[model samples]
Structures are given as C-alpha cells and as structure tokens.
Target: MPATLPLDLFLGALVTVGLLAYLTYALVRPERF
Candidate 1:
C-alpha cells in the first residue's frame, strides 16, 4: 500500500546509514574489533 511504502523506505535508509557508520568506525579503530 502507499502508506507502507514510506515506512519501508525510511527503515531501509536507517539500516543503510547505520551500516555505513559502523563500517567507518571499525575502519578507524581496527584494534578493538
């Protein structure tokens, strides 16, 4: 439905951002991980 489309997009964007941020952090501090 139209109403669920925006929610799906928002969730997808949030997950993508979180993954990118985590990757950046891991790259910055390789010793911890």
Candidate 2:
C-alpha cells in the first residue's frame, strides 16, 4: 500500500490538471473544429 502512494498522487494530479486545462481551453476557444 505504501509503495503506491507516489504513483497515486502523480496520476491524481495529472488527471486533475489535464481536466482543468482542457476545460479552460474549450472555454477560451469554442470555434475550433
């Protein structure tokens, strides 16, 4: 269980940031096709 801490945090942060970035990009540019 302890060994998974680093991996878990890395993935969690990656997903959270990725989602936020995607949302922001979408809102900033809605004319993209």
Candidate 3:
C-alpha cells in the first residue's frame, strides 16, 4: 500500500504537468490548433 501511494501521486503529477504544458502551447499558438 505504501509503494502504491507514491506511484499514484507521481502519475497524477505527471499527468497534471502534461496537461498544463499542452494548454500553454495551445494558447501560444492558437492558429495551429
């Protein structure tokens, strides 16, 4: 259970960061999307 907790948190953070990056890129270049 302890090991799974850290893995879950890491995956959540990774996904959040990816979403933020994609949003920022889309905002910067709206023409491409």
Model 1 stretches with alpha carbons more than 4 Å out = 1-5
List the candidate 3 regions with Cα displacement exceeding 4 Å. 1-5
Look at candidate 2 and tell me the lDDT of residue 33: 29
TM-score of candidate 1 versus the correct structure, residues matched by position: 0.81
Model 3 deviation from the true structure expressed as Cα RMSD, one decimal place: 3.1
- Of 1 and 2, which scores higher on TM-score? 1
Candidate 1: give the clashing pairs.
none
Question: By TM-score, who's the top model here?
Answer: 1
Residue-level lDDT tens digits of model 2 in 1-33:
465569788999999999999989999999982
TM-score of each: 0.81, 0.71, 0.80
Q: How many clashing pairs per prediction, in order?
A: 0, 0, 0
Assess the local accuracy of residue 28 in candidate 1 as a C-alpha lDDT between 0 and 100: 100
Question: Model 3: how far is 17 from its true place, Å?
Answer: 0.3
Off by over 4 Å in 2: 1-5
Candidate 2 lDDT (Cα, 0 to 1): 0.88
Q: Find the 10 residues in a row with the least total lDDT in model 2.
A: 1-10
